[model samples]
Target: MTSFGIATAPQQVEYADVLRVWREADEVPEIEHAWLFDHLLPIAGDPDGPIFEGWTLLSALAARTRRLRLGLLVTSNRFRPPAMLAKIATTVDAVSGGRLDFGIGVGSRPSHPLARREYAAHGLPFHDTGRATDSLDEALTVIERLWTEDAPFDFHGEYVHLDGAYGNPKPARRPPIMIGGRARATLRVVAKHADLWNIPGGDLADCVARSRMLDDYCAEIGRDPAAITRSLHLGVSYDAPEATREAIDAAVAAGFSHIVLGLPAPWPGGVARWVADELVNRSPAHRGT
Candidate 1:
């Protein structure tokens, strides 16, 4: 089934406003998933606005909604240590009744001003993507082992080191781990590890091209390309909702099974309703059998 979901940009909205969106979603049975971004602050524009923490917001939302699968689009590995992150995902998944999608990324763009500000605020030394990806390799290693292993173990890596690590209360179900990226190095990580590969903001042909590149990586790694679900994050216009319909159809045609519709915060008037009535109806999974 082609699963469609909402991935909200929370920079412009407050806690209460976002809650309304979640409640609106609760009223719409067709909407399959609900998501947020793991941004310490806004990705762009004025960084002075209120930016809610992704995991905390998700934990709160978990208590409010039942059906919509929850996740951040791509959480940076630098935000939290690897072992802790795995435990957090485990706890949230248990609380949400196995509805978590563990979306993670290497890190944010080193050149981005907001990212730089965020790093400075958190006292995490900023590094280029190369170093970030290396750390991410180690981080994912720890996360997966902790999530699945039955006994305590030690993790030794260049960037991360741990001993007697145990992720208790293992999730009732294993949530799909989505690695989000576009570059070749990141794609290799996705090929080797990701349960779902999410590529954010790209045209149709670009997505097809990237998918092929990921396929190449899978082949080189002696892995099946089909093992990983391909997901696309597309910016949508609720005003011209037809454009969204076309984009969703095009993305599905291009071999993306999971479609994440990204909406600007302070939602455009009637957008949520339009999504429920129009966009969700486009999904065969949402339609009548």
Candidate 2:
């Protein structure tokens, strides 16, 4: 069966506004998960507008809401050391009663000038795509080892090196890893590591093509393609509910079983129920299921 979730980017919005939506989503059975994005500065309107840090805000949201699985839509692997991220995620898992889904990826691409500026503004190094992807591969390796390894260990990778790294009081559960990206190198990592693979939805044909490429990569690695859930992140249109429903139907038809509806800011009151009634319930995928 298909699962549906909502993403409220922590950009240009107040914290209480987000809390309200998540609390409502918690009571709605149709919405199984919720997310915030990993961005330090505004990526949308009013570049100087306030935005909350993703992981910190997520912890607060996790504590506030009881039912929804929560995490950043996809964390920027560049923002924190893998071992540090492992510790943070474990804490969230405990706080949420084991409902964390760890989503991560290489940071914003070099081409996105708006997203790129945050790196410099925050004194974070923004490497080229090749280097960034390689780093992500290494980061995931280090993170998983920290989560599962019994003893403190050291890792010497090209991008990250750790000395006596360990994660204590392991997560309530090892959160399922979800990696989001479309690059082939990223896809190879997804095939090898991710429990779920996510791509932003726009053109249906391109989305399916990327999914097929992932399948081929899985074959090369001798991993079952079906082992990884296909997740699509599609933008939600409060004004055009039918259009959003149509997009959801097309995505579900293309074999995306995990749908994350991206709700833009100035979130309407009762948005979670609004989503269930207008988008999730109205979509043919949900109706027939």
Candidate 3:
């Protein structure tokens, strides 16, 4: 059975409002996961717009919701050091009773001023895509080792390094590590390290093709393709004439185990209600009464 999830643009709404909406959604049986977008600055044209820190908000969400799994839709590798990021994730997992999923990708919001500043601050080779991919590979290794190993795992890579560093109180559950991106280098990283794959900016056929590639890579590496969960990040607009119910049905049929509905800009109150009614209420699997 397909699991339906929600991905909200928290920066567009107040933190209190987001917490309320998430709590309500958690009570709704249809919703399985609640995702938040991560960006150093607003992705839209507003440089002075309000933006909440992704990790901090997620840590709060972990405490507020009971049944819903929480995570960033995708975190930028440029935002924090890999070891620190892993530690933060572990703490969030412990607080949430092991309901966290770590979704990560190479930087995407370079157009934002703060994001550009972050790139500069880190001295990240943003101009060189190859260098960025290499950095991501190193970061992924550090994150995974931190979560799994009790003894300090020494990692000496081109971009990241660790020497007899210890990570304690591992997560109650080994929260799934999801890698996002459709590019070849990104997919290779997913094949090598990710327990889940989140595909964005693609149609069903494109997603299917990418899924096949992931499976092929898994086979090449002697890993089981079925072990990796496949998901899609959908840009959903309630105003569209297309029925939301049909859209969800199509998504499930297309093999998306998780559907992360992208909130429209300017978080309209009715959008959440509409999703609860038209999508969650109408679904036979989640109708409360």
Task: State the lDDT at 190 in candidate 1.
Answer: 94
lDDT of each: 0.84, 0.92, 0.77
lDDT of model 1 at residue 146?
Answer: 88
Question: What's the TM-score of each model vs. the native?
Answer: 0.94, 0.98, 0.88
Candidate 1 lDDT (Cα, 0 to 1): 0.84
Q: What digit string (tens of lDDT, one per residue) describes model 2 on residues 1-289?
A: 8999999998888899999999999999999999899999888899999999999999999999899999887999989988889999999999899999999999898888889999999999888888888888999999888888999998998989999998898887779999999889999899989999999776889989999999999999899999999999999989999889989999999999999999988998999999999999988899777
Mark the regions of model 3 whose C-alpha exceeds 4 Å error after superposition: 109-127, 268-273, 280-289
Rank order (by TM-score, best first): 2, 1, 3
Alpha-carbon shift of residue 108 in model 3 (angstroms): 1.3
Backbone N/Cα/C clashes per model:
0, 0, 0
Candidate 3: 10-residue stretch with minimal lDDT? 280-289
What does the lDDT read for residue 238 in candidate 1? 60
Candidate 1 similarity to native, TM-score: 0.94
Q: Could you give the candidate ranking by lDDT, starting with the highest?
A: 2, 1, 3
Instruction: Say which candidate scores most in lDDT.
Output: 2
